[model samples]
Target chain A: MSLGGDWYLALAAIVFSIGAFGLLVRRNIIVMFMCVELMLNAANLTFVTFSRMLNDIGGQSLVFFVLVVAAAEVVVGLGIIVAVHRRRAGATADDLHILKG
Target chain B: MTHLVGPLVATTFVDALTFTVAAAIVLAGAVGVVVARNPVHSALMLVMTLFGVAVLFVEQQADFLAAVQVIVYAGAIIVLFLFVIMLLGVDRREVFGRENLRGQRPMAAILVVLGLAGIFLLGFGAHWATGAPSVAGRANAAGPNVAKLGTSVFTTYLLPFEATAALLVIAVVGAVVLVRRTPGARGPDDQDDAGLEEHPGADGGDGTLAFGTGGEASGDADDGDGGERGDLGHDDPALGSTHERKMTS
Candidate 1:
């Protein structure tokens, strides 16, 4: 059987789902950030697969900017997580109950 | 079968084999990231997953993306994860049963399962992606994955290119604003004179204020406070008091 482009897309979908599942279940802020990075990678895979299938370079082009945005996002997100963890006694997800109301 | 096998068949065999191996690694590492107890171990597992995805990208002819994947995600981001883990002392196994929200785990499982179903419907059960998005002729004129991407980004996507640059600067400045301590910041020791009455919001006020003077406090801690331990808790008065008690004992 020929390996069609759809196989790559399906793999990306599975990875994306795994990332989503991790994001939903995990409590640690850092782990959540890793999950997000995982999701982004899956989306990048989809984009590149479509790029190859369509013989277009634009999807690959979008992946470049997505990488930039992801780097900036990680910088800002980790800063927040670090700040919150430092302010509280424990870094558990439960410790962020200031907005419990 | 052997007589009919040609170069084309061999090429397809290699592609399928590579895809199978890479996909297996990616999925296994992703599952490990979810199930691993130690945050550092999970981070390492995430590195494995990223590397696998990079391999897939290379296979798909996104060579530049594969390089960037290794450099940016595996190189820089994983280092940041390890750094935060070391700084917070959260490298050890974490307690998983200590969820803050009620039914958080169950609800998460349900939502994630639904999300998976949705993705399946889109991926396997749909025909939407049969057509690839059309590209402008001028955009594909540069040739090759890397060069064509460069031309398309600098020309057709120039507006977004400049926009994300601004977004990156904002994110950098925001991170600095969030984490960087101010000069001449107050310390918990200084608040002893004022007392908790004056600053009823002293805990938060002190937490941040303590970080302001954290540079000095950290220096002091490094000078054999608990024999060089408890330096990270230098900014928290609660932890600092506990350290004092520990020292006395």
Candidate 2:
């Protein structure tokens, strides 16, 4: 098939679905965090593809900010994981039900 | 060879080949990420996916983005993931198909199918976005895309750009504070208990004498141990130099 903006956007969508699936099904919080990252990447790809198709500078510039946001998110999210793991031996999502009644 | 009349055709062929390879790598890596039982393996798969996306970016002529993708996403973000994986010791094989919540798998499956179908519809079923014939910039074809990106960022989008820098600094400092373990921060009781778990071999080696005479071999080894030892060593019935030497701190 010809590689077009539509093709790349479709790939992004599929990848995003896979990430969301993993996020929902997996109990391991670390893996869930990985899934979140994957979703972010998929979004980034879509942004670049749309930018290329539109011939606009704005989409690509937006991608630069997205990268920074992703980096910051990684730092914070993994830090939370470390903190949770320190208190509890396991990082299972099941163990994080302390707030529940 | 020097007078070849097919330079443009050669580039198109090369682009098609690269796209095929990169797309395959990305899809395979995405599958690997979900299917892999071990989180560490999943992390490696994520690296593969990130690399493939970088290739895709380069193909789109986003040279600076391709570099940033590899450097930031693969280099830093995924490295942080691996660190958490190793530190947390969550690398053990995940119990497959085990759902802590009822209907979680079914829900996820339905959501996945819906999501994919909707996205496909957005792409094909509808004539979707109003993408023009082609971008005027064409990235490097017009001028250096990065230079163009810099000029816009500093001009039109300066406020958000500065805000992002501030956001990153806060994230860095906050993460450091959250993960750091300062001495005497936690009480002696929890500290000693955590110490026992920290050194499993020490717990097993020091075994019965570590906890209680009636302590089970592996039971005391796994549970919150080092309590009796802490009491004996710190302020209780002085158990002599041997017990004191055994203390972690």
Predicted model with the maximum DockQ: 1
Question: Which lDDT tens digits does candidate 2 get at residues B1-249?
Answer: 111233334456777788779989998898888888779899999999999999999898788999999998888888888866654555645666656678889988998999899877656656555655433244434578788778767877889999998999999999999977665465333554334234335434554333321122112222334112232223221233234234311
Question: Residue by residue across A1-101, what tens digits does model 2's lDDT show?
Answer: 12567667778888999999999888778888889988988999999887776677778888999999989988998888877655554537877785376
**Fnat, 2 decimals, each candidate:** 0.53, 0.53
TM-score of 1: 0.76
CAPRI category for model 1: acceptable
Candidate 1 second chain TM? 0.67
Give chain B TM-scores in order.
Answer: 0.67, 0.66
Q: What is the DockQ of candidate 1?
A: 0.48
How well does each candidate superpose onto the true structure, as a TM-score?
0.76, 0.77
What residue runs in model 2 are displaced by over 4 Å at the alpha carbon? B1-11, B126-141, B182-193, B196-249
